[model samples]
Target: MRARNQLLDTDEPGRTVLTRHLPLPALHPVDYARGHAQFEARSDQRRRIVGWLDARLAEHPAEAPLSVLSVGCGTGAVDAPLAAAAAGRAVPGAVVRWTGIDPHGPSAAAFDAAVRHAAPDAEVVARACTFEALDTSDRFDVVTFVHSLYYVPDVLAALRRAVAMLSPGGRLLVLHAPLGALNELAATLAPETDGHPQWWSDTVIAELAGMGLRVHVEELDAEVDLTGCDSADRALLDFTVQAELTDEARPAVLEALRAAARPGGGLRLPHPVTAFTVRPR
Candidate 1:
């Protein structure tokens, strides 16, 4: 089954996001980590999410523990730090039940270790599976999909499922990369998507609006340090395009980076992400 595709392109202002196939094969988890590290302003994103989670914590006290479901929690690099932060925020006897699921077993295993180490008091279940594979009827106080929705088989279905899993007054938080200049070039150079659409934030937001849910949109700004970026920079390059580039694709990628070059003697690709916070019944 093709299993994955989304609505036509939704252009952001001042940038033309090419609606061709995204790079093939996607980035390996490790490469994704390295490339994401190049993002100059990720800490801002982390803080915003952690604050949102902290608010979720405030909704109840020790008597009523917060339930959190994290979809596509890979390696817990972004999540574990905040998980540790949550540990400190919890009242002396407060409890948090955290469930994280990712298809990559190794990454999930890593997440298990990190969260267990960081949030010792919280009940942690790190499973290696898709959102659908983790069978549970329990409602969550907060559910998040951080930059992982683009790879899901069905973004809208996953979003819907997350909302359904919410407890009353619960919030669903999603952070996804919006269509931008750097991604525009990558999309143009990449090979077949194998039927998987690299969904942008607008598509997901539109879906949520179609469902009649109120979504609070937050625009985030960041930069990818593409200084000296070249085809040989395999980890960052592969991550930038979400796939291994061809000989033909490399020069064009480099040219695109240069075109967006920073005034200071290197390339700084403007990478923006959008946060969608939805509170449903």
Candidate 2:
């Protein structure tokens, strides 16, 4: 039987996202951690999100507790930071209940441990399920999709679901890499494995705008360091492109990636991140 709300690709109506295949290594925690570390050094959007949330919470002084639903939240990297920030804001008896959903069980468990370590006072919940499979009646004051939109079967449908999950005046935050060096390199290195559509930052912005929602975009500048990385790291980087390049392609790929790096720095690829804050009209 067909799922009631399955996300079907427009171009391939018969092909749903459920049957879509993805690169296994791309989801590896080690790769994700390494990539996230590089971006963390360059930008502080996590803190920025905290400040944004603090201001929003200030607007509703009566709302003592804020519910945050994080889709594709992994390892408490971003969510835990936000929780720690929320704890410090100390919104006079502010209780933040954060529920993070990720399909990876190990990552979800790690997230639980990390949140406990980072924000012990903050209430945290982790669910091992994909956002498409998540079943929850509870809505949230804030919904976030941080670097996880690409995996969604249908971007537009997922955005609509995010809208439905929000309370009145609630906000949705999306952080993703646009058509920058990483994506470009991915295309050049492994064109055959680019299964996901090129729905970059602009595509998302336009989609949100078409829905009559208010959207704010902030670009984060960063670089992915390839210097001193071992072979395993290189494999992970190849996995990101969803293609395992051959020994022949490796040299050229490395050359291009390194050439794009900042002068005097490691093979730093320009990774421009975009943050979108969306709200219903």
Candidate 3:
């Protein structure tokens, strides 16, 4: 059985506190760097997604070039690798056009800089706007939301927008680690903390099916092993924990993480991601 922290009585009604002070750990700069580094490291996964899209495009006898739009494309992580893969392809005179969109203030400039640094020749266009904010006149062969769907206030609406932007036979992909089992575990361990919203899985599939889109959902175990990572690589973990937990519960969560860490060792957390591929009917 895991050691449990004793709960303390608080004068405030319906409130309880821990006896010990639990400070959230600070993640190392290296950890912050790893988020960006991991994107580049996952070239094979990017290629697989791009290849899948290419195959789908090939299935149709479309004479025009393939166009791909990546929604919520943060820092051009997915876009850069995808462009590289398309450029390396042997498609005879096949032009691959790419568009990256994000509502993040710095996304456009940051993505442009990253793409120029990585794949200068790639046809990449980026906009600092959300799917809902974008003009509906544009359509694409492939549209993807990579780990950014959760941030949307109305996931169903955002998904609908994505599907609407797909050209005939076009594919819409949603890639993120579902917070199902992990969320349950976290809630069980710490009920005070609000777990991730339940709508992520429920609405995405339902909306896709209702719109007459053929949906393919796959659960992929892409765990990030932080055991060998240094202190610099743990900052995101710390910030994430602190950001998610309330002040009263923050310390306990940090303490829990501290307990998970081995002596003179690093920590490992499960990162199970899910990918949904929806093709027009």
The number of the candidate with the highest lDDT is 1
**Stretches of candidate 2 exceeding 4 Å from the true structure:** 1-63, 189-195, 230-232, 239-242
The lowest-lDDT stretch of 10 consecutive residues in candidate 1 is 1-10
Number of the predicted model whose TM-score against the real structure is largest: 1
Please give the lDDT score at residue 17 for candidate 2: 32
**lDDT string, candidate 1, 1-281, tens digits:** 22121322435454333333343455665766666555424235555555655564555555556678888887787667667766666777667878889987888998889888888888899889987778888898888888778767677788888888899888898888777776665455444344665677877977887777878898767666666557345666766766765556566557656766556766766776787888873
lDDT of 3 by residue, 1-281 (tens): 21233333234454334333332232333443444455335224454554554454455444456678888787786677666655555255566677888776476667777765665555778888876677758788888887667657667677777878888878887876454432332323422212343344555666666777688987655433444323333333333332223356554444444444445545544455567888777
- How many collisions per candidate? 0, 0, 7
Q: Clashing pairs in model 1?
A: none
- TM for every model, in the order presented, reads 0.81, 0.77, 0.68
- Candidate 2: RMSD over Cα atoms? 8.5
* C-alpha lDDT of residue 281 in model 3: 71
Q: Give the runs in model 3 whose Cα sits over 4 Å from its true position.
A: 1-64, 90-92, 181-199, 227-235, 242-251, 255-266
Give the lDDT of residue 19 in candidate 1.
Answer: 37
